[model samples]
Target: MKPPTVFMGEMTNREVEAFLVDHQTVIVPTGSTEQHGPHGPLLTDVFVPQEVARRVAPRVGALVAPSINYGLSYPHVGFTGVVNLRIPTFMAVVEDVAASLATAGFTRIVFLNGHYDNTYAIAYACANAADRLPAGVRAFPINYWDGMTADEAGEFFGPTTGLHANRGETSAVMAINPDLVDLDHANAELPPFPAVTNAPAVHTAFFFSTPGSVHRASQSGTWGDAREASVAYGERYLSVVADATVRMLDDVERTFGAMPAR
Candidate 1:
């Protein structure tokens, strides 16, 4: 038999009401619409999390909510097609979604994040939204990549995997949708980290100082090698993402109690 439609957008209102009768957990995919080098599409951040959510939804028997496509991309502001939401705006968006889910009877709102820059914004939004959530409702924000070790991630995408438009992410996009990647034109460029101390002033100057923006640090809009990215590697990485997400969902269920009989 075919798998049931787990996407919230694909289900009817009545279907959702009925779904909530058995399932009290909802997975929200949070991502960004920004430049992902020349090889990766602008929607790379958005698509990766959504795909990962879809893969794990069935295992957890949870509904995958409509994704929050735009996120805080201030670091990539100077890049073309990069639309960065202000911190407040991004926080509001996440809070609103979590509130909506809780109001709709979801006991647990799990946000699967893909954008590295959205880390603190998501955490702050969830913490602030806790008071707004009804009793028994809680929000959990997490990144799918966090399941893997830093060394493992670096191995797949090169050492600069933490940066934007790297090999691992490009390979993931390739695995999900080969048509979106232009491997032939892919470039490898790792911007130099500032030679300053561990002081906040130096760090702020590098990221917040418009004179040394992301574009200025890396001219090709890429941070690591994408030329070596391959569909096979992407498939492996995506499988890892799916497995890791499912493991996390398992933990959530264990911590929150399976479905809660809502």
Candidate 2:
């Protein structure tokens, strides 16, 4: 059987109304427009999450809204292609998008995030919009990497991986669009991991507060070794991310079911 049109932008108004009759869930991809080292494209943050949404939407009987391409990228400001949105602006965009979907009758909305800096903004937007959302409409903002399990993480990132435009992200993008990856320019920049890598409070504060720190840490804007990245590794990363997203959708369905017929 042919698959339903999962992209919201592709459907006619009537088709959308009909599709929503059966599927009350929607996925939104949120990403940043910024530098991702030399090998990764400036669009990496947008591409990875959007592609994950596209791949997972069909399995969960959901529609994928158009991507929120610009995000909070202050840390990467020194880079040539980096573009950063103010926190309020980024959060407002996400809130309005999710609220619109909720008003349109989607009871479950998921924001699949790509950029490291965009996480809090997306979550804040969803959380703040909750009270205004129609009854039973729930919004969740989650990172695409959250889908990777410990074992999967070992396979994808592990000891060799660095943060930012390192192995994992480069590989994920390569899987999505090999043409976008320029491995010849791939480089590694491993900064000293903070002494306590497991302190949530400390890490959270550091991640949120330090934007210029990227400049101080690595000249290449890279965190890990991308030389280890490969098409096969990228495919594996994507499969895990998509599978994880589908599982999340399943949980949403199991907990919320579909909205009562209008």
Candidate 3:
């Protein structure tokens, strides 16, 4: 049988209800609208998760929610076209979305997040929403990058990866949407570590500079070399991640079924 088509923003309410009735799980792709060096498109971060959602949803009989295209990207504000939501606003959005899914009888809600900055905010939203959900309702916020192992990173990115607009991210974007990437501009630059590091800074206030200043801190907007990125390599890396996600969803579904009702 052909895989189910993901529900886009234009999907009707009746269609959404129909999918929920047939599927027990829902996947929400979250990404940021920010600069991704000079080579990758600003939408790269979002596209990775969205693509993963597109590939994985049908396998698990899950419906993909409309992608959350905007995220907390204040650190990249120095760059053009970067948009962000304050912590409070981001949390509210996550909470509202999760709560709405729970009310609609979606027992499993998986947040497929691609942006590093969204980690804590999405986690907080999931935790808070979980408390108010029905006993069987389950929600998980997961970072696509976090799902990879050190070995996987080493194999795919080697030694050059330095976070942000790095090799892995650049490769991912190229793999998913090569037409949007401008390889001629791909460059690598590593940021300097601060002498006096503050305790793990979580809020956007920690990095209030514009994208230009942020870019200035590094050799180039990119933290790792994207010159080696290839569509074939990207496909392999994506498969690894996608396989792991499928297993995790299965585990979550099984665990949810075994849990006692509230």
- Candidate 1 vs candidate 3, TM-score winner: 1
Which predicted model would earn the best lDDT? Answer: 1
Cα distance off (Å), candidate 2, residue 202: 4.0
C-alpha RMSD values across all candidates: 3.7, 3.5, 3.6
Q: Model 2 Cα displacement at 209 (Å)?
A: 0.6
TM-score of each: 0.88, 0.89, 0.84
**Any idea what lDDT model 1 has?**
0.84
Clashes of 1: 0
Whole-model lDDT values for every prediction: 0.84, 0.82, 0.76
Ranking by lDDT: 1, 2, 3
Weakest 10 consecutive residues of candidate 1 by summed lDDT: 154-163
Which candidate do you rate higher for TM-score, 2 or 3?
2
lDDT of 2 by residue, 1-262 (tens): 5355788888777888998888898889889888888888998989988989989887878888999889988777788987888999888888899889988889889998888688877788888998889887889887877756788766655535666788878988888878999999998887665677575676566657888667666788888899877878888778888998777666666756655756
In model 3, which range of ten residues has the least summed lDDT?
A: 197-206
